[model samples]
Target: MNGGPRLFSILRQGPYLIASIHTALDDSQLVRFQQDLVERIGSDRARGVVIDVAALDVLDSFASRTLRDIGEMARLRGAVTVIVGIQPDVAFAMVELGMDTGRVVTALDLEEGLAELDTYAAAPPAPRR
Candidate 1:
């Protein structure tokens, strides 16, 4: 995580913590990526995460599961995880593989995903007495 163009970039915009995944995510790198994310979230308490997957082309079962796990883990840490840039064919194939992406918010592109995260960030926090 210290070099190699950064598997993911952690950006802090106001109250939102965005993690943009710029490299090709695979089984070999997914675990390290997740560990990095966990550390970031633990430190920042980010309200939302935007995973930019535009650079990825082929996603196997392990990658898909990693994504799903990322989403769930982010949620457990109180951050919303949104996956962006998933191509149509890849999405279709993921569905065929029964990858439960239902928990992960998805966007066609980074801009849209960031916008969605903005909305989530802007929403009023739950009432706390």
Candidate 2:
């Protein structure tokens, strides 16, 4: 397997990786996406990730959970994951479904998401306990 998704792409932009989902993806593809994303973050030494799902019309519970998991995994790699471009309808549906994003940050668009990454990058690291 190429460890890549056909329905979406993970493009590198400096210290961030942008996962742009232009269309819906099946469960298997989502898994591949999760794996590929984490791997790329390490291989590319990315400081952050932005998952853009604006083009998606529907975001189901499983997909939402998978996204949350990806965010958590990325964080473990010392990278911040921000999800952007969630459509209004899909955002409502996620709220109605009671889906939570956990520690993942969200923004309205790519520019905002990148700004979030910049802010996080500029912030000092959490002091060790």
Candidate 3:
């Protein structure tokens, strides 16, 4: 692990899961991390994911798109994705850029985000076909 606050941390809170991203999430890194997350959730039986983004100083188009894609991908795998610690300025920038963040659940801080994950996990699962 890189000593610089770690790029990400995968934590399991009962049936809920969190991927606390502690650095700027670029495209290549996001892809690899998402794959790792999928695998982790597969083994851990987690129902939701909280992506912590407090340490990121910037959110560009590529990063924003990657986040959206990750969220969608996680959802396809039956895991809800929440974006946490989005700075106000960064959030504004994303909105200004026309990035549709509506699909992403947002939280002001990591703890709040994790709490949301707990709620999602506790909720009833969707009915299967």
Backbone clashes per model, in order? 0, 0, 0
* Superposed Cα RMSD, model 3: 2.4
Deviation in Å, model 1, residue 117 alpha carbon: 2.0
Best candidate (score: TM-score):
2
Candidate 2's C-alpha runs over 4 A off are 1-5
Give the per-residue lDDT digits (tens) of candidate 1, residues 1-129: 555567767787665666666777667678888888777877887878887777777677888788889889888888888888887777788788877576788988878888888887779876666
Q: How close is candidate 3 to the true structure, as a TM-score?
A: 0.82
TM-score of 1: 0.81
Clashing pairs in 2: none
Error of 2 at 13 (Å): 0.7
Error of 3 at 63 (Å): 1.5
User: What TM-score does each of the candidates earn?
Assistant: 0.81, 0.94, 0.82
Error (Å) of candidate 2 at residue 51 is 0.4
Q: Candidate 3: where are CA atoms >4 Å away?
A: 1-5, 126-129
Candidate 3 lDDT tens digits, 1-129: 465556788888777677877777667777777788888777887778888888887888777777788788778778888888888888888888887555878889878877887787778887888
Ranking by lDDT: 2, 3, 1
**Per-prediction CA RMSD (Å):** 2.8, 2.2, 2.4
Q: Of 1 and 3, which scores higher on TM-score?
A: 3
